[model samples]
Target: MRASKNRSQKSEVRSQNPKTYEIHISGAEGVYEDAEILKIVKEYTNRALNHPKGKPDNIVITLEQIKQIPQKVPMLPVITLKCNSPDKAKEMIFQILSDIGVPARTIKNSFKILTSPRTMRGAAIILKESGVRVEPDRERGVRVSRLGIEKNTEKILVRKLSKMKVSITTVKEALILASKVAAYTDVIAEICISDDPDYTTGYIASKRLGYIRIPNIKSHGQNYGGRVFIVRENTNINRLIKYLEKTPIIISGDIN
Candidate 1:
């Protein structure tokens, strides 16, 4: 009986085809980090293996280090997939890794992450597990989705803006002007104003114009000075132009 069992085990090991290949995933930071990649890999692997009844053979996997790459190429990291049948495993990996960027390839030891490069710090594993949607923040240098902003914007803005002086009058005026501009133009992101000492008045004017206040503006004095306000990229240029022309607040220098 013992001899027969040994033979059966050996035969199974030999007959079982192992799949080996690489899967490119988001890097170990930002939206998709190491933990997220690993979790997704494991899920795919299990699915590929079909949840075998008995102990499964160990499949060797390698993770490529995260790094920045050209904009034409993806910035995510590569995760190598190994199994008895590379082709089968590749298909499974593609099916399982949805929302996350996945590249196609043949039987290989390694793959590359072909998505936007992201910083791995503070990456939320829940997102990976749930496959949450993400939107790019091209202007702010961050990868934030609508859900992410909705969840944290109030808290974040309140804390950051609390220290800075905010005049209700100025804020109301900025909002009114900004609303008109937003309706007239294709601006999606809010207009940003600098808070330099000399530009305080301009900043206030911008606020009164109804533009969203961007945090971390250089400190400005209580009164408006000759500071230049920058209309952030991707904003409604027409609206901004109209506001500039219609608004009476001077950003060039202090009004005498």
Candidate 2:
């Protein structure tokens, strides 16, 4: 019985065809140093191989250090509107989206989501004559879709923040991501409402208008906020999403 079991195990190992996956890992120097991260990876690989799902299939992870040539794209210029009241801010947002060819009905529907407390994950509304539909990526904060949109990894973003000479903050990161989405081929415009109770400001970004910030888009303590990406007609949703989420896009020091 012992000899037969040994033979079976050997046969299984020989017959197994291991699949390989190349995962790129990056991080800021101080926050998650390379050596420390590699250790974490090693630990996780062992945990995954022993996971309770079933008899673990073999998984081998290899890391290669490469000179990351980050694509430095220009940051959009800021165009702050002198609107303080939430109502006025709302009007301005509507007018801007309407001017950019977003249908009146779609704009209305999007605003509904922006104001709703339930839309914590935000949404991507595809513009089509047939009808507008919302796509959600709840698991991942708001990228194009589940495929994952690659905004700056914290490391790359930190480097860009230094180049731009700006204070690093979550709001800044959101704006940068918005700018990249605006530059995409089928994306007509983008609107972002801050969920922070203290922050009543929001912005709309697009290739045509740069980044337009509107203060008091919502009242303080209102607590509801989200993003809306107004995409163009007949867009290859999956492909556009892949570009938005997977491509390693970074913002440059140059503005406008």
Candidate 3:
């Protein structure tokens, strides 16, 4: 079997802020034993930590094991959440964030990004968990992936997923990743809407609220959904990225 592993790191910006890093694992199309996967993760993570940049403040790991199924599963109906007015929907969303300790200014900006027409595909918004930018400008929120989950705090996630009945190994793996991100030093909360055309639900996860599902966060046939992560200022962007790409975290706790 021909399998290839890749590792690389880049700065999120040239400024003095702590740089963000990414370590990606791909090009493997065959199944391997669990011990083998763990070995790969440890070996790479050690290399990253030993680099000249020094040890990262946090670490997270993701393993996307690809598999093919012969048949397609049917899509479920969109979970519709009714509201009395247009603002009501926004209010409810804002309330969830507020209840979970997201700053007032951050909440407003996150909502703008979520509803904005310019929100791009294949990307999520990253904002300071404690800032007060008057508008939802790009500087206020960066369009990036793998940052919110450190692409969303990993700790806030485990509590949410731990309560669910996740049978699929992939789903459980994802939940563990989110949990790890939420637990980082600077991370605080995360909200996500699936970009899948067939899926219409979204979720808000934090250390306080656990995982609360929003039944109808998006519309069927619409593919504009995304994720938002709120984190503390001056967080090391490079260190966070390294964790997301390099760490190999196991699916802990009882996943029934």
Candidate 4:
């Protein structure tokens, strides 16, 4: 994995000011186990701390040590969200709508239980206790619908947002109405995710919506080099806006 380059690509996805970043678990691989590795690190640290001056035994690495590491966050990564299969699309839809600062409620996560009567009853009780409404269905174990979320729309440009935002995670089995919308992490407020200029729905949508900021893939030909689609120059954003307005496309999804 070109970790550096991959980070650049994901940065292009715009997000709302997401203070609560979800915890991500990346697999760890090593010849040593966790205990062994911890021991080695402790020893190395103690030696470095003492250096030329002899250090006391008490001044050693403690168990309560905190480590900070530099890393990258994915651009609106949806696959990482914690939700059941059926409610995944609802999660994405609501997240996208909310991020764009649209005041819309009642569009997320409903569960349809298909377990036996005993199991379903137990599940229903738990959900009800958690303040999630559940109703009995003759055909299904239990039926739950509609998720309500709080969205405060502060009229602002979609782009130029500088913090990690939680976006929708389109799952493999998700199907939105009549359209076969593919599951992807749709960047909050901004939706352009393709490197292909031919595919321009998101760009056009942003223009029409008056949210001028849009994402473009990093390209050397255009001299727009970065990991993701970021307008490095403030003036460059204006330049692109002009270029996109005059640029022509043969179809709705196509762009110059």
Q: Go through the candidates in order and give the C-alpha RMSD of each one to the true structure.
A: 25.3, 13.4, 14.1, 24.4
| lDDT value, residue 41 of candidate 1 | 65
lDDT of 4 by residue, 7-42 (tens): 123444565542332111111111223456566565
Tens digit per residue, CA lDDT, model 2, 1-256: 0000012333455566634332111111111235566675765565444432222344444443424444555666666788979889878887887776777787787787788764343345656343376465542234431111134444555565577554455446655677667767787877788755666778888888988878789988765677777777778877776666555555655444
Off by over 4 Å in 1: 1-165, 194-211, 221-256
Instruction: Choose the strongest candidate by TM-score.
Output: 2
List, residue by residue over 21-106, the lDDT tens digit for candidate 1.
22211111112245576774665455334421222343333444434321111111112223334244334434433212222221
Ranking under lDDT, best-scoring first?
2, 3, 1, 4
Q: Which ranges of candidate 3 are over 4 A from the true structure?
A: 1-89, 116-125, 129-174
Residues 2-109, model 3: lDDT tens digits: 112222323535556645432221111112355577775765566445433234444444565534321111111112245444355567778866776667888777
Considering summed lDDT, which 10 consecutive residues are worst modelled in model 4? Answer: 172-181
Considering lDDT, which of the candidate structures 3 and 4 is the better prediction for this target? Answer: 3
- Residue pairs in steric clash, candidate 2? 148-245, 149-245, 150-245, 150-246
Off by over 4 Å in 4: 1-79, 83-86, 105-188, 192-256
TM-score of each: 0.20, 0.62, 0.50, 0.16
Candidate 1 vs candidate 3: the TM-score winner is 3
Name the candidate that leads on lDDT.
2
Better lDDT candidate (2, 3): 2
User: TM-score of model 3 relative to the true fold?
Assistant: 0.50
